[model samples]
Target: MTRLPVLRTPRLTLRGWTFADTAAALDVYGHAEVARWLSPEMTRVPTPSAMRLLITRWIAECVGLPPPAGRWAIERDEDKRVVGGAVLLRLPPGHEDLEIGWQLHPDVWGNGYASEATYALAGWAFSHDVDEIFAVVRPDNARAAATVRRNGMLWVGETRKYFDLDLEIYRLRSADLKLGAQTSQRPPGHGNDD
Candidate 1:
């Protein structure tokens, strides 16, 4: 089994999904608001049983996936709640580009969990020798676009290359990640670690 590294930030832990996380995972993937943005790649998870199966597949699939290219549950440290999901996977077709993405339960939308996860995932990918990571956001997904921008992902125009959807592509190099860390403010309630 490929053991995913546990990545930590001030307020979140980006770690592998476990069977115990199935219900919390459902709270994130079962909602249409979160699922809609994931269409074509993933459909809304309908039932607890289905979600359990999906989690099983995810856990099984991790063994074969390359390092740093897998999914994680975005768990908040304060209450240890699984607030969202994060991914660093290869884009489709050519499979040469890496895509960084996050999906939060709508209830936790403004807490900056996604932004923190993005940086944590990107830094982890960089440590694995990946050069640049991209985030493909639907033009209508203003919130996601803002998160990527906040993480120092540069706008690189639109593409229909990945999920067969028109998406605005944002690129982030290792240097850009450093710059973003130097300038971006932590979300309220997030501290520099007392």
Candidate 2:
């Protein structure tokens, strides 16, 4: 339950969520395009206040969550703006597998941010002793499927185990990662919140 690690890629920084990031977060989650993919577990955040409450909950929950299991704000290094969100959480029903997810604003859709975030998350998780990670995409989510593939995840087929809906599962093992593509983590006090 230490502070969420700060992950840095060449162009983006993945750090802990903060109340101060509500508006920027809303810019991503408030849009129908982005929220449509996150069904059942989350709906479109209606307002800045609602987004703030959600961030508060995420912060509180992470304090008790295990290493590599927390949410992160995907910020662009050049502009220092939050462009999306990322998470590594235990899959439901079994809670044995770790799932990696990313949500990006439509404005930044084609920028390779999702792929960068995916690699960063995978590297961070593996460095903490996680053997493998998964990404479950809705059957029709081509963008997500492509992103996972671009990150070197292999399609393992479909399942209805998570969220009670059909999803395409993609997996990446620690041994599959390329050397030097790993992300660098800042210490507890070096992240956004502290």
Candidate 3:
């Protein structure tokens, strides 16, 4: 069996999905608000058996993949709760690019968890030789788009073919990532950690 690696940030844990996280996974997907941005096929409340299978598949994929690509369970360090997921998918065929995506519990909205985790993951990807990272957020998801921007990604306009819905594309390069690093190192009280 392959083991999934764990990634940590100051406030979050990005790790492989485990059986223990199935309930939280289901809770995240089962919520209408949380599922709004996901594929329609996965919008329903997942059965425990189905969630287990999904988690198993995710663990297998992570173990077999290299950096710049894989799914992760987003856990909150304060409460140690599995809140959601983050993914860095290797772009398809002609693109030879990388795409970053994430979803968090609705309750955590407004917190900077998503942006913090995204910046850390993007840094990790850069270390693996990924030159660029992009994110496609639905036009209606203004909050997510803002998070992408706050992380130093520039809005590159829209793409119709990227998802089931029209999406606004945002991009960040390894060079642009230096800004995030500097911002992250600021003394406490200078800015919110989230």
Winner by lDDT: 1
lDDT of 1 by residue, 50-135 (tens): 99999998878777789889989889999999998898888898989998988889888777677688889998999998989999
Alpha-carbon local distance difference test for all models: 0.86, 0.84, 0.77
**Model 3 CA lDDT for position 120:** 72
Give stretches of model 3 more than 4 Å off: 1-3, 92-95, 181-194
**Residue-level lDDT tens digits of model 3 in 70-170:** 88899999999988899887654445668888888888766777777887788778888777899887888877776777777888988775544677888
> What tens digits encode model 2's per-residue C-alpha lDDT throughout 13-122?
99999988999999999999999998578999999999999999999989989998999999999999999999999999899999999999988877777767877898
TM-scores of the candidates are 0.94, 0.90, 0.86
Instruction: Write down the RMSD of candidate 1 (Cα, Å).
Output: 3.0
Model 3, position 146: C-alpha lDDT score:
67
Any runs in candidate 1 off by more than 4 Å, and if so which?
Answer: 189-194
* Candidate with the larger lDDT of 2 and 3: 2
What order do candidates take by TM-score, descending? 1, 2, 3
TM-score of 1: 0.94
